[model samples]
Target chain A: MDVRSQVSMVFHLDKCIGCHTCSIACKNIWTDRKGAEYMWWNNVETKPGTGYPTKWEDQNIYQGGWERNGDSVSLKGAGKLRGLKNIFHNPYMPVLDDYYEPWTYKYQDLFTAPEGNDQPTARPVSLVTGETMDVKAGPNWDDDLGGSPDYARQDVNMQKLTPAEQEVMFQLERMTLHYLPRICNHCLNPACVASCPSGALYKRGEDGVVLINQERCRAWRMCVTACPYKKSYYNWHTGKSEKCVLCYPRLESGQAPACFHSCVGRIRYLGVMLYDADKIEAVASVPEDQIVQAQMDIYLDPFDPKVIEEAKKNGIADSTIEAAQKSPVYKFVKLWKLALPLHPEFRTLPNLFYVPALLPSVGTVNNGIYNSNTNGLWGGIDTTRLPMKYLASLFSAGNTETVAEVLKRLMTVRWHRRNVTVGDVDEKTVNAALEDTKMDTATADAIFRLTTLATFDERFVIPPAHREESIEMLENTGDVKGNTGFGFKERPARGL
Target chain B: MFNATLNQFLFVIFPYAALAVFLVGSIYRYKNKGFSVSSISSQFLEGRKLFWGSQPFHWGLLILFFGHLIAFLFPRAVLAWNGEPVRLLILEIASFGFGLSAFIGLGLLILRRVTTPRITVVTSKMDVVVFLILLTQIVSGLCVAYFNRWGSSWFAAFLTPYLRSIFVFDPDITAISGVNSWWLKIHVVSAFSIIAIIPFTRFMHFLVYPVDYLWRSYQQVIWNWDRRTIRNSTKHSEGEKSTNN
Candidate 1:
């Protein structure tokens, strides 16, 4: 089976509150450097709005990821011939203007003003040039204004919706928004790794963490265009490309990643998934509509005796296998089938899965008693604030049934929970809802527990990384014992 | 004796000294300061100007470099081909065209580097030095091509033998000493000077050009330990579909 262990993740979009605490935690840990001021390794993007880098989802403009070519896939922007052809000056590369010129207030001016004016204020200075500039944009410029014409109406996914449906989405009372906290998906077939001319970016075989060897990165900037998610960023000061490392240093020590640990709404789930490496190509090569199912099928069940034998033969530790068995990600993604990978059409076979968020139920209280006033506790998927086609575009490859099926399961869980806890939902309707979605009470309850009330340990099932086993093979660890600092051996500078 | 001594210093001693520095310094930098080896592009800060400057400069330089290499490597073939008047004219004109392109591209690049405020922030002292030396070399080359005329024939007849003699440890200077044009002499001297400073500047990036990328597998998976054993053990096994059954 060519079994391999990947540290997979599931971000429950339902629970996310768009607080950006995860972004701050990630920033404080990794990207608070001179060159990385604009990089947000963990960015909370509001769906139905143009994301960071402005309309990044429009592949025609950004040209990130792969396109299916008959039996195989080719990079949309970069490959051997095309990459070398445009190596000198990449036309697709997004400049600092695309990501918004990072700036900080000239607070010194606030104190050192001539004291002639009635009020003193700090002027914004560009981090790139140290020149005074007008503030035009920011990373989260359209934070909660998902209904605004400038950001939300311009969403690339909104192209799939009918004009009337798209117009209805902008109505003040009917408008809905959800937070999509994004990090590197750490895809099985990563375009960033393939696009790197210097062979600097590689997916570590041990844990499947994609990383850029800064020493070997020649500033080709191909990865910055090849990455479908626009996660890889070029550092102007360092003259290198950087991306999310999935907090591997913390992960190696058996601690959750900083973002996962500090997530305020507890929307993040981390666990090991044992996947069949042989299937990665076939899965990624499939048509866009079949990609999600093909990708999920590649993740082998950890408890299967034959799969466990193959995993052991491939040198996966028993504890990691056990962690995979108990993985909350596996249950939400594979078992309950409630979560879906974001943009499966990208054909990178991304490892991160997202449970589609259920929009707030549309209902009215007739007189006094608070009633949901629908067939069940919640209305049908069609009646939700965000259209099914829009969610389909975001998660599936415009597969509305997949989105509808997941939402139905989530709705059944809510109904099942109401019947159990509150006793308001009648047994007949709840059972029928459960039967209609093909989910039993136990499965619904389990999905509910993992979705809503999972403990820290339950949510983050970190396996022992066994880094020493791998590190010893590469170099003499004893020689590096005295070196504690993390800065480069030779600082990244422009010239000699 | 003084003229002969000067010719020996410039043609033999100076060339060898530069070659020594190029070889030793490059190896040392590669082994120790691997992290600093990169093109160190500033395109992110400013790209539009770079597109105009970088593409033409690179293409022109690459074509000229390979053209010189062919002439030096196959002097007999170049000389034979140059025997025909029409052929000789075409070769000279093509070389001059490429040289002019390189000159114009470099001019734009220098202007962008000097005038653009953002680019100035990243331009180091060494970068300016490299740029100035490169400018001198290109300008001297264009001057030789324009004024000297039929450099293809003369270069094949004289400089090829001189370069070959130096590589073979013969240290012949008469082949280049008889040359009258100062522009050609300056071109030879400045070319050696560039080789000397290559290791100390961003030019070291050329040494590690990713030529293997053309043939190597696109997907790069790095394993700290041996993965062949892992692959072999599973080679005979069926995929997950069979396992499910």
Candidate 2:
């Protein structure tokens, strides 16, 4: 089977409040440097609004990720022949303008201003040029539906909706939105790794964490276009491309990543998944409509005796396999089938799965008064206010049935929880909801606990990284004992 | 004696010293300061100007570089080809055209480097030094090409022998000293100087050419297993066991 272990994640969209704590935590640790002023490795994007890099989902403009061509897939924008042709100038690359010019207030002006009639102001200055500039945009310029007409109305996912359906989504008082916090998907078929001319970017075979070797990066900036999610960023100062490292140092020490640990919503779940390496090409090459299911099918059941035997035969550690069995990601993604990979049509085989958010219930406005309680708190999964087709486009590659099924399972849990806690929901409806979704009470309860009240240990199941084995293959650890420190010998800098 | 000594210093001593520095310096940089090897592209700061400047400059330089290499490697063959009057004229004109484009492209690049405020922030002392040296080299080269008609023939006949003699450990500057052209002399000295400073500047990117990308598989799934076993999968388990041991 050629079994391999990949650390996977599931982010529950229902509980996210979009506080941006995860983004800040990641920034403070990894990207809060001179060249990385604009990068947000962990960003909370408000759906129905254009994301950080502005309409990143619009592949027609960025041309990121892979396109299925016959039985095999090819990079949509960059590969061998095309990459060499555009080596000097990549026309598809997103400029600094696309991601907004990162700027800072000239705080010194407030402190060192001369006496004047008017109060001294901290004028905005471009971080790139250090010149006074009019602040046009930022990473989170469209937070909380700010500039809805310009940003939210331009959302790429809204294309699947009819004109009338689109209008209802933008109605002043009736609009619905949700927070979509994101990090690197750490895909099995990463186009960034494929596009790098210098062979700098690579997916770590042990854990599937993609990393860029700083020494080898030639500032090609192809990865910036190859990543469909716009996660890879070019550092202007270091003259290299940078992206999320997935907090491997923390994971190696058996702690959750900085963003996962600092997540205010507690919606993030981390775990390991075992997959058949032989099936990745076939799985990724499947038709767009079948991509989500194909991806899920590739993930081998960790508890299966045959799969476990193959995993061990492939040199996978027993502990890692045990972690895979207990992985909350496996439960949410495979066992319960409630979580779906975001935009499977990208053909990246992303490891991060998302539990699609339930839209607000449909409400009727009577003589300028809104009555939301008439149809109860939760609406039918098929007739959500945000439209199932929009969610389908974002999550299941236009498969409304998958989104409907996931939402139905989530609703069953809510109904089951309400019947037990509040008792307002009728027994007949809750039982029928469970039966229709083919979900039992036990599975619903487990999903609810993992989704809502999962402890830190329960949420994150980090397997011990057997660094000694990997290290031995590269260099003698005993020879370098006490000789190396855990920091960069020389800071990454540009110029001769 | 003084003229001979100076010629020996410039042609014999200086070339060897520069070659030594190029080898040792580049190896040291690659091993110790490994993270510093990069093109350090300023395109992100100002791309539009870079496109106009970099493309023509690189294309012209690559063509000219290979042309020189061919002449050096096969001087007799080049001389035989140049025996035809039409072929000789075509070769010279084509070379001059490429040299002119390179000169113009370099001038545009210098202008962009000096004028752009964002680019100025990243400019270092070595960058200025390289730019000035390149400008001198290009200007001198262009002057030699324009002033000395059929210069390619003389280069292959006279200079190629001198270059070959040096490589064979016999320092011969007889042809070079006898020619008595300041433009060609300056061009040779500047070329040697560039070779010396390559490792100390961003020019080191030339050595680590990403030519492997052309042949290697596009999808890089780096398995954490014995690389030998990946190449020869029949001994996969045996190789794995040995590596573990």
Q: Write the per-residue lDDT of candidate 2 for residues A404-429, one digit (tens) a residue.
A: 88888898998999998999988998
CAPRI category for model 2: acceptable
After superposition, which runs of candidate 2 have C-alpha atoms over 4 Å from their true positions? A373-379, A466-475, A478-496, B221-245
On DockQ, the leading prediction is 1
Off by over 4 Å in 1: A361-372, A376-378, A467-496, B227-245
The backbone clash count of each candidate, in order, is 0, 0
Global fold similarity of model 1 (TM-score):
0.93
Top candidate, metric lDDT: 1
DockQ of 2: 0.40
After the best TM-score superposition of candidate 2, give how far the Cα of residue A171 lies from its true spot, in angstroms. Answer: 1.2
Task: Put down candidate 1 lDDT per residue, A406-449, tens digits, no spaces.
Answer: 99889899889988999986898998898898989889888888
